[model samples]
Target: MSIWEMLAVFAAGISAGTINTIVGSGTLITFPVLLATGLPPVTATVSNALGLIPGSISGAIGYRKELEGQRPRVLKLTVGALVGGLTGATLLLALPSTAFETIVPVLVALALLLVILQPRISKAVQSRRARTGTPAHPDGGPLLFIGLTLASVYGGYFTAAQGIIYLSLMGMLVDDTMQRLNAVKNVLAAIVNSIAALFFLFVADFDWTAVVLIAVGSALGGQIGAKVGRRLSPAFLRALIVTVGTAAIVQLVLR
Candidate 1:
């Protein structure tokens, strides 16, 4: 790759890491840059998945405080994510590139809608919980497990707004503050991405230079996001997610 291309990927990685830490959909920032560098779609997707793993890990660590008392929740949900991620990775390797391309825009659109309506959804969830006098299901019952598994499968396939999907679902079922639920979302996303990365590492052709650049940039960006992102207003963050998700849909359609 040319130095300019490398620089662009690095910059995209920084933006992706920060966005992933804050709200998700970081793939929208990085995937097109990889394509511009002349990688095939599958190669770019897999390489990007691997490159962002460190950033996901860093972001999860950055939210360690919020992770407190969430061990059982994390452990239980991780199983579903792992299985779903493996299933998605296998499908990615097995299916034609056109199949993934066809679905990604729809996924982005759904994520955008979820971001826009999350406040109403949260309120409804709170109201329902109060009316039923049922506590939040930390274990995330069968319905939550199924939903998470599906989201993980999507994350393994595209990874754009997987975090947004997770946040929306968890907000309804997990019965916690947004910040705490966000912490859980980060860890679950990391698990899904890590499983997919491992699959790609063993089975796919990837650009090592691009991966390295993204890893370095994303890792640094993760730390920056963790330190500063918590202060941002939820409204601002949700707006940012919607904007990026809309861009992702446009990019997919144009491509």
Candidate 2:
């Protein structure tokens, strides 16, 4: 890769790390950049997935305070995530790239819609919980498990707006503040990506140069996101998600 391409990948990594930490669709940033760098689609996806793992970890650590008392929740959801991730990764290897090419644009569009609607959905959930006197549980229940599993499958496959899907589900079902749910989203997303990355490490062809560039950049970006993201208004963050997610859809469709 040329110096310019390397710099571009690094910059994309930083942006992806920060966005992933704050929201969940950082893949939308890094994946396209990887493609532009001349990597094949599957190879780029694998490298991007592996490269972002460290950033995801860093972001999760940054939100450790919010993670308090959430161990049971994390543990309960992990099994489904692991299974879904493994399944998705295996499918990625087994299926033709054309399959994903046809499906992912729809997924990206759905994710964008979810991001746009999240606030209203969260308010409605909160209202229902208040009327029913429903107490919040750390464990998000079987429905959440199922929802997460499905989302993780998508994360394993492409992962552009998986975070939005997670946030939407968690926000409605978990009865928690968005901040706490964001932390949970990070951990769960990390789990999905990590599992997929492990599979790719053994089974896929990847570019180490891209991985290293993204990892280093994303790590730093994760810290920055954790520190700064908590201060932003939910409306602002939702707008950002919508904007980036829309861009991802356009890129996927136009490609």
For all candidates in order, the CA lDDT equals: 0.85, 0.86
lDDT of 1 by residue, 1-255 (tens): 999999999999998898888888888889999999999888999999999999999999999998999999899899999999988888898987677668778866876776677788868977888999977666668888999999899889888778878876776566677777778888998899999999999998899998998998888878887887677677776777677677777877987
The TM-score, computed over Cα atoms with residue i paired to residue i, of candidate 1 is 0.93
Q: What is the lDDT of residue 14 in candidate 2?
A: 96
lDDT of 2 at 249: 73
Question: Model 2: how far is 202 from its true place, Å?
Answer: 1.2
TM-score of 2: 0.91
Clashes of 1: 1
Among all candidates shown, the one with the greatest lDDT: 2
**Candidate 1: global Cα-lDDT?**
0.85
What's each prediction's TM-score?
Answer: 0.93, 0.91
